[model samples]
Target: MLKRIKPGQARLGMFIEAIEGSWADHPFWRNQFRLDRAKDVERLKSSHATAVIIDTDKGVDVALPIAMTERSSPHPRENLSLKRALRTIEQSKPLITEMFENARIGGTIPVSHAAQAVEHIAACMQDSGKALIEVTRLKARDEYTFLHSIAVSGLVVHLARAVGLDEKMIRDLGMGGLLHDIGKMRVPLKVLNKSAPLNDVEMGQVRLHPSHGYQLLAKQGDVPRVVLDICLHHHERIDGSGYPNGLFDKQISIAVRITSICDVYDALTSARAYKKAWNPRDAARLMLEQEGQFDRRLLMQLFHSLRL
Candidate 1:
């Protein structure tokens, strides 16, 4: 059994299964470990993690009655919301991993599975919008690619609803966001995960993902046109500065526009191997400063919708 306890409650004998925060907020390189060193416990307590998940079966357990109750006692409703959000993300992992892996190997794209994942994400957003978004923002480095798709999917749904799009279109946009970076599967891991700045060749290869993803989906023969459009054009900026075709504002559809904002916002707020995650406020502000990179009206709408 796993129990969440305050970081302060973490003792030397506990087995830390996970820490409840982004990778940038924790002091340790890995999430799971047996807390054997006194200094390590102190380090964890001083870190920005609000809670630590300990596997009670592996090491000494905290007093169950007190630890469990106190963990949820402060705000049971909020805790429940977080748990639902976590559950939704966990359910999405295998579905998404399989979907992307299949795409990488020339297998058919599972539209039904993708739609089901979108529905799960959409339902989670409706039930716990803030909690779901907050949970999506906390991505582990190794899980970044998978979690990023989930995060962008949720963000697009949220923004689409905020803009009052019809239900079908909203779901299509969700699907688009979910698979927007499918082309990245074609990029080599060495290029994708490079810690240092990329050379021109690497940068060019990275930029090809939109077209790569578009071709992958286009070959599927049954993907929605809207989804295919988003996969190809999410990178295209309003001012024709983006990749592939460098489409101008008029050529971009509203769905793609919404997706672009969400895509960039999630990317900005997510921790990458080459950069620390920017806080929401800073990320939004920086996006605003980048002239013509996104649709200003929709971007503002997104910021307002998210209350950032």
Candidate 2:
């Protein structure tokens, strides 16, 4: 029998359907499926996720227990348990909902206000670390962006604390991470949501977001340059393979360097439409193997930071 899990409870199980991100736009959803109840059941069975979040977007489907989907082959990020995923959804859903409401009202949740929330997200990571880690990591997929931003910011708090950074740096890192991708709001959703691979032209348009984000955040009152720099350079690479500026070592701030590593690590380990999520170990190995691409010493620090 399929398990019905409470919001806070998690478990493991097998998949039955594709969990749709609410941001996913398809004509059949409204025009075709609107009048068909039987179709929904059939579609659900075919897509067959063991547990699904009823009213959310971006990793909203909470799998029952451990979940195993049909393998396209072995993937690095495929270690999520249905239970853990659901537990994450349950634990994270309410917090994200609150953040959304607050953001809509133009209430800025400052970095200082995040301490309690950061601890809570960190605590949730001990078990069911799949969406647990990412929920704390960020959701990023519309109506979910603020929570995603907060999740990234929360990670900065935890990570900064892990490395014994001073309180000011920690706060700066969190705010920077939160606002890092704010530029994407101006980009076209077609490019953001396209299921197919983006061509070079499309990709080029997508890449302009860092500058856009920096400009957007700059207009807001008193945003620290540190945060603005993160918005600008989080895409930069150690070997200069990153976007926008393609800056090299010493050119990027320590904060950008730190946030860059964390951002990429979370993206690799989290589920996405175009790519299966990677496992932490695999993602780490890949990052490690990238060879002179990332700040090794900083990566090491970040790795050790995860132990806390």
Candidate 3:
């Protein structure tokens, strides 16, 4: 069983399943570990995490006051819906993380596993689509890269449905969103996570992610063509200004166009190590201001579907 407790309640011998807050604010690299050292406990207590999830089956459990315990419980129906969404994201993280790590090590892409994750995300969106997006937006910096994929997958699934795409295409597009940024795994972490502005050379390396991701997925024989197109051309703009291919309007596919909109929207709204998160309304407004960068009709559809 997993229990959420305040960091001050953490003690030696407990197994931490996760820390709830920005990973940038914590000293530990790994989220899960057995709390054995006193200094580690002190460090966690002093960290920015507001809550910690401990696996009682693996180690000790902490006792909470009656009021605190009661406060954790919400109205059952609402709680279940939100919990279902949150649980799906938590479960999907390791799967996505492992897949990316495997890619980094020159392993094959697990298309079946990734498809299953997309299915799970789609189901959660069915129950609480808005809640799922809300939960994903709170991602910790440490897990941002992996969770961003899941978030984009959910957005793609939502937007695909909004535009009345058939079920098969929706799933395919969702898969595309999940693996669209796989190329970033090949870039150096220093460049991906640098707090300062990237120089021209660093920017060039960052821009190569699409081609890198495209080549990596192209090697996977069974991957769908739509997924391949999205992985490579998502960065391309309709005005022929984007990179790698620089194709003009009509040269880009509808699926790629949608992924590009969601990709940029999520990046804008998400809090990165270098910048604070933008409000949804403000992010949407800013995206609208960027001329020729995205498909206007699709962007408006996304805005309406998300009710932003």
Candidate 4:
């Protein structure tokens, strides 16, 4: 027999048939497992997983007193479970990857291609905001450009909704994130793939990508202003420390602020050839410590959305 119960209701001996949150948020590599350790139980309890599915026959049956409550996430809006959201992201990656590949060859980033990918992500966000953003962190080191675009777009969708932006504005923000790093496609693979620290000249070359990407998108003549802002300014820090442009304080728009947080968070947690991946929890903490580097409210909203 299988049953669903709140994460808090789970007991020590129960078999966790499926966790209801993103895999990035949990420690387990496999979804189905027996809860044999006290720490595992505690981790699940503290996780963003609102509910967990367990096999009564495979482990201990639910305790009588705890089994009587409703079997759903505390926030019922999370109708799309983590597993389903991950599947959606996986299916959407290749479409967006092809778009990036085209851009690398002097191809224009068709708004149509971006709309299809953002539509799919918006659909996933309608299911579960947390899963849509968190699950995309699971990607190969070589896929940073392709996957990072998708990840930031998804995060923008979540942030846009959280802040009550209208549908049109939200869509524009999503499009910007999907194409934010399109300029990197113009950067030489040798510099982008270097496994060691870059010299100043190399770093200078690397920083030109935003402008290069912006110029490419601008030529398309159909890119939205919000999308253009993100492409050119996602790297621009609030304190004037970022590259391509030293736009500081009010110069950075909310769209750029939201995208930047998602952008940095994904970059930190992702496994790059140059450095090992930081744990999601550690990445969130480090971002909080960077004063004047990010918008505080949007930064808090990113963590709150991820339940980290």
Candidate 5:
């Protein structure tokens, strides 16, 4: 999915050098990097190339080119425009360090480097059709709306595959998951990233997000009702203890129930200011201990389905 790029993230009129599918220690990637640096890597950087990523193969070259606009590259031959690449990056990331577990084997990732990583993932997804986007989700927190979208998408896709949803439903679930937290974009970053617990007033503002998200998507009218319902009802619970609408067992769709479990699990497992991630076993134990807070059957399904 595409999103609007924020300020300072775009680097126009640059020589963006992109490589694909060459693993480290592999002769091809090592040789290519050596040859390129020996020749003109400094020149490429000086040209202000937007982002560069070296991967394992060469048939795919999905650069968010300086002049393309299409988001879905469709086939390998098409060029991915920079705007679309920025859109995908903004739509699918928190930042490099948060998204991937071992992003920097040994050093700090500054703001500029983090931004470059987001751009690279977007370009790769648009260019290569690879969901290496998953790598970014490895250690993410609730940093931005896009981070939430990516997390929810992964969880939904994982659950959909386990439950045997067909291709269309699975895709729909992905789109829904991607936008489930769109409303949060309107919330203040200070509030969303609050260093301390929220008081009653701030908590109320947070609670309004689902209905707000529903309204935003409702205005667009492109997403189906099921997807919209998932956005709104994902916060609802099986035992009637959730918000936006405290939908109970018979009140919610099975899909919505499953999504809630997945969403909760992903959020909990992800590192955030308010909480640290629990180990997979510990997280499952906590969920199971909650009992009526979640749908028993679906929680069981989700617990067993985790890639961990």
Candidate 6:
């Protein structure tokens, strides 16, 4: 049997089935756990959370008076429709971190595993992209690189859906976004995390990441051409003024156009060591002014998709 009780009524032996609050508000990092410590119970009581659900099957149940009479309500985060998507993002982080570490060692990324991760994100995006986007904003400073990958993946999946692409193509684009900056693993950590602006030499090295990422993906060989194109050309411009290859107009593919817009959108809105994050609306507005730097038609589509 399951019972709900106020945090004040929680006991040490109770099996905490769920904490009725936001992840930030909860005393524990995870939703469910055994309330076996006096500190844990006290922590829950002191938190802003109003209630917790307990499973008698797993541990002690609350007293009948409170469990049977007093009502306890679960918070929205506990019952959110996008709960599974939030969980998926948590699960994907370590896997992606390992993939990047492997790449740093000259090992091939596990393509099959990456495809599965993309599919998981796409499924969640199809259901409630707003929740996933909200989840992305909660990432910490050290997690910027990996979570940025996830954010770009979510944004690309959202944009691809808005533009009416088929499921396979969307998954491929999500994969492209996920691995777009894989080459950054090759850049020195000092350069990647410097608090001050980069010198010209460091800036030049930073600019080489696209080609570095392109070459790394190329060596993998089995990566899809669309994915490769996005990895290589997402930084290129429309009016003949972008880098690595400086390819102009029709020279760029639709995949590159879409990925580039989504990539810049995530970067501009994400916090880094050197700059604070831009508000989504402000970031979109700034991108709109870049003129020939981005595809205007696609940018408008992205703005519409974001409901801006």
Backbone clashes in model 5: 15
Cα lDDT, all candidates: 0.82, 0.57, 0.82, 0.77, 0.52, 0.77
Candidate 1: tens digits of C-alpha lDDT, residues 143-255: 67887898899999999998899989989999999999988988988998898999999999999999989888898788999999999999889999987888997998898
* Per-residue C-alpha lDDT of model 3 across residues 79-160, encoded as one tens digit per residue: 5665576577766766787789987877887888788899899888886777677656654555677878988999999999
As a TM-score, model 3 comes out at 0.78
Record all residue pairs in model 4 with backbone atoms less than 3 Å apart, i.e. clashing. Answer: none
lDDT of 2 by residue, 1-308 (tens): 23343322222221222233343422123321111122343344444233433332322345321234333332444443323433444444455445334433445434333334444444444443444454333243443455455556655666676677887777777667766776666667788777689999989987988887776656656677898899899999888888898798789888988788778877776556577667677888899999757888878776776642
Give the lowest summed-lDDT range of ten residues in model 1. Answer: 63-72
TM-score of every candidate? 0.79, 0.63, 0.78, 0.72, 0.58, 0.76
TM-score of 4: 0.72
Return the lDDT, model 3, position 238.
85
In candidate 2, stretches whose alpha carbon ends up further than 4 angstroms from where it belongs are: 1-59, 63-144
Instruction: Estimate, for each residue in 254-308, the C-alpha lDDT of model 5 and write its tens digit.
Output: 6687678767776775556677656657888888899678888777777676544
Please report the TM-score between candidate 2 and the true structure.
Answer: 0.63
Residue 305, candidate 5: Cα error in Å is 2.3
Residue 303's C-alpha lDDT in candidate 5?
67
Q: In candidate 5, what residue range of length 10 has the lowest lDDT sum?
A: 6-15
Candidate 6's TM-score:
0.76
